[model samples]
Target: MSEATTHQIPGLKQKKVFKIIVLGDSGVGKTCLTYRFCEGQFLDKSEATIGVDFRERNIKIGHEDIKLQLWDTAGQERFRKSMVQHYYRNVHAVVIVYDVTKPETFHSIASWMQEVESHGLMRAPRVLVGNKCDCGTPESRLATTYAQRLADKYGMPLFETSALLDSECDNVESIFMTLAHKLYSKQPLRVVSVEGELGPGVVTLGRQKRSASSNDSCLCS
Candidate 1:
């Protein structure tokens, strides 16, 4: 067997790591989502992420230890140019998040999607996340139809979650875990064939298919 394939064998391995990038507009809770998944704690408020912040989490999947190197980028408009110029080149997966309560945040999805495409990372695995679902306010509750439309347009998996309640938070990890497994196994990343053109689609990087539905309630305002 090839060296790469041999590493995937159970109980016969060396250290392996995967790099993941979290991209979204400022105040869209990108950091919160990372923290919630990595540390299992949520801060009510946080300063905007500077140039980038790094977090590492080890998750075991089917007898393999996958070390996730998560890169969180600053989402302010000022940082956009720099990210486009230098940040996304080495990323394995991209998580695009937006605040469900703020339609404007939702509207900006197209712009972020554009950025991802500009970098030619469209083939990368992407997970569309709608945050702040626990608020239960009219604004925070995103219509399933709207999310599905976006998902179909991008050929990506759409997941709605609330970091405050930890709902479907594990699902976020699962998405990345599946991606890592495929990458380690040397399989091609899966791509969904979007039906219509709503906007530019993201690059998908895994072969496994998952439902475009929210698994639990973990919304926060």
Candidate 2:
């Protein structure tokens, strides 16, 4: 891990921080995916996150220094209701994960998305992930087409990845880095805009413009 430099270069922009929450059912590998990206190592075993856990990583992209605060939330029904508000509060992005081998987990994505919508995080950059791909066989895994269809329905990109595999672990990093870049580029700070001559100004933020390849950009390649 590289230490953040204390010395500041003249004219250089200060580091930007973003908060990202990972949501999924227990055993869907949310914690493992986060550990791989932030720690660069696969977690062979982990207990269910109690309510929430946080991890931070410093990265640079195109001359921009970024700090990612990844919040790994507990996926159990018991823990969810108590912490849902806190999890969605001030979140810059959302990552919805599902186990490729288990179709039920994939089905639960809709409910999870509904949770995001209920908390008014619909405008936050969100992505869908099918995890543990390496553990599934052709007979057991859900088709990529179905996953893509869900992603298309939600207007978000879909990535199929295995955090436990050395070869595919880089995809895990790509997933978060892609979101970091998107949030950094959007600069979602509060801004006041005048709508009419005799009306009060409106404050707007969190709106995003979709790119040509945004819906299909899978960094797994």
Given candidate 1, what's the lDDT at residue 115?
Answer: 84
| TM-scores vs. true structure, each candidate | 0.74, 0.80
Predictions: Cα RMSD each? 13.1, 10.4
**Which lDDT values do the candidates have, in the order given?**
0.71, 0.81
In model 2, state the lDDT of residue 155: 90
Q: Candidate 1 at residue 120, lDDT?
A: 71
Off by over 4 Å in 1: 1-4, 7-13, 136-140, 181-221
Tens-digit lDDT string for candidate 1 (49-163): 9888888899775686778888888888887785545657567677889888877888888998998898776877788888887766775577868987997899888887777
Tell me the lDDT of candidate 1. 0.71
- For model 2, where is the 10-residue window of minimal lDDT? 190-199
- Name the regions of candidate 2 deviating beyond 4 angstroms: 1-13, 188-221
